[model samples]
Target: MLPHDDNPLFATFARAQIRVERGEGVWLHTSDGRRFLDFTGGIAVNSLGHAHPHLVAAITAQASKLWHVSNLFEIPGQERLAERLTEASFADKAFFTNSGAEALECAIKTARRYHYVNGQPERYRILTFEGAFHGRTLATIAAGGQKKYLEGFGPKVEGFDQVAFGDHEALAAAVTDETAAILVEPIQGEGGIRAVPEVCLKGLRDLCDEKGILLIYDEVQTGIGRTGTFFAYEHSGAEPDILASAKGIGGGFPMGVCLATAEAAKGMTPGTHGTTFGGNPLAMAVGNAVLDVVLGEGFLAEVRRTALLFKQSLASLADRYPEMIEAVRGEGLLIGIKPRVPNGAFIEALRGHEMLAAPAGDNVIRFLPPLNVTPEEVREAMRRIEAAAAELSGRPAEGAAEGAAA
Candidate 1:
């Protein structure tokens, strides 16, 4: 064994102590035989939860047939998925990718190419909001504009400008003759689950139309039924010309896609852009399987109903534990709680109670349970949360002392 302090892999993520062996539904089983209630849902990627039967069967079936094939050959799964995605959303064309970052990259390229084909090569700059988390790529990090992520990364990529979020005046002022697109997340996932109001989204659509620039949505976290809708933009009635999607798109599988209107993608002809592993048979199979569940009859309605129940419970919990939780926020299953104590402390407390959550910007703890989570699961999570809050507030849990006495 290596030294306790040494690791062979890059020391990037501040990983938790437990070693997860396997998972099923909303629980993670550790190597030590401990089962934890999983609320992070693989950072909101496990839409149907861990090891969903449908996903498992699809992947297994695909593996037995073809694991991978070059993008040069036609893949029927990709064609079918693309058709379904376009029929369901505002896009008319879709480009497959392996991750959210690649989708964003493709979106950025599509927007610039659209302007170039329109005979305006200089109109390449894209406007983004402050407090956004696009991705970790060189271009996406530049678009996110967070100083911490950009720090030490030499010479930030050019053509991206940032403005105060929700500030119509600043956003308008920031737009210029060189602007090619306005990219935003309907709900900022890593930015403390901040949502752009419906009116603001409409205003953005109007702004883009008035300026003849494309509107791009980085829906990597808010799409695929996480926001009580097929895509969060549907809630606002402001359809984007280009959108980057990932996270739950493939349930637990690694996949992403960039969707665009036919006009927006007109410039991306043969040989302009391509990916070697994107749209592979395996990824396509899983993507199709995920859609099979997400698009099933009444599935999205159930997600909305469950989200309402969970958020109401969280609101009540915040009211009861004002000393521990400051507020509740977010839409659908993508919920966040602002803690009275440090967010890290609250996360650790939850972990101690055998519950898992993720931390976001602005000191918020995210509770991203699987979209198919049941009401009983939500109630169980609340019980653990109450216990954690009681401990932090120096109060005995509701029945803990009584149980001990008995």
Candidate 2:
């Protein structure tokens, strides 16, 4: 048995343990029977909320029929999901994976291979921005270009260069003959819910076009209707040679996919790279179920409408308590509140009101409620947030007579 706060094989995450027993749309129930509004969305992994009937039905049905088979066998679910992804984006090919890190790793290899196939093996470097969070793999830590994550790891991986977030000239100057690709996240999630400027996205597309270097967008956090769009890149029409998608792709299930243009995919042949458990029937079936809801008629449109309502509500909240929340940023359900105080303090205050939010870098608290969260839920959440802000900052509870300033 595991002692309090001590696990033999599992590392402790933050400082809390809920032992969540069940979850439904936008609400999680702990083993003690307390309910909390889950704005964290499993840190943006639960795209369709928890325990959706369709996802449960599909996974249950598939699990009963067949759980998994080696990549050596044909899988119809993979076929349909791949076709759906390509149809929705500029990609001509796709490769499945079990997580976002693996998807990004494949993208890196594919980008390098593109250069090698073009007779430029020396083009191995990838230009990534600082304050970016890609993943935790050895190569990804290098690609993220963050020193904090790489502190304990010795002898950093080679061929990664860091540049300023929106500096076009600095980014352009960083690119050299050795540069094979430019990797960026459409929205930096973990590093903070920092949205890449549209001008910078388009400028990178233009620069990559002129230099013949591949452009890769890591949509692991912003994809699958998180930002009220099928893909965050669609917001700017800045298509990349390769795009990595995960997190929300499988609703709550684990799945990741790398979408690449035909030219880029050409570098990845049958024997060049593969994963045995990546495209198994179980994952594919869940992926299909997720896509069915995400790509369904009027589903995303409703999400966009909800996004507008959420913005109005959040703006009002910010206006009411100017000290606790500095500004509201980000798009869709993937909203971020730049806190005047520490984000950790804000999250702690939220716990008192039974609202759960995830903390990000740069003093930002990410609000990632389920994509299908209703207006009533949003209004209720706003009330709790107002109360928390008032309590945390010692401000008047919104229109209370005691503190008329609110």
Q: Give the candidate number with the greatest TM-score.
A: 1
List candidate 1 segments past 4 Å from native.
Answer: 1-5, 398-406
Tell me the tens digit of each residue's lDDT in model 2 across 33-59.
788889999989998889999999999
Error of 2 at 103 (Å): 0.4
Cα error of candidate 1 at position 138, Å: 0.4
lDDT of each: 0.93, 0.89
Clash counts for all predictions: 0, 0
Q: How much is the lDDT of residue 92 in candidate 2? A: 93
Q: How close is candidate 1 to the true structure, as a TM-score?
A: 0.97
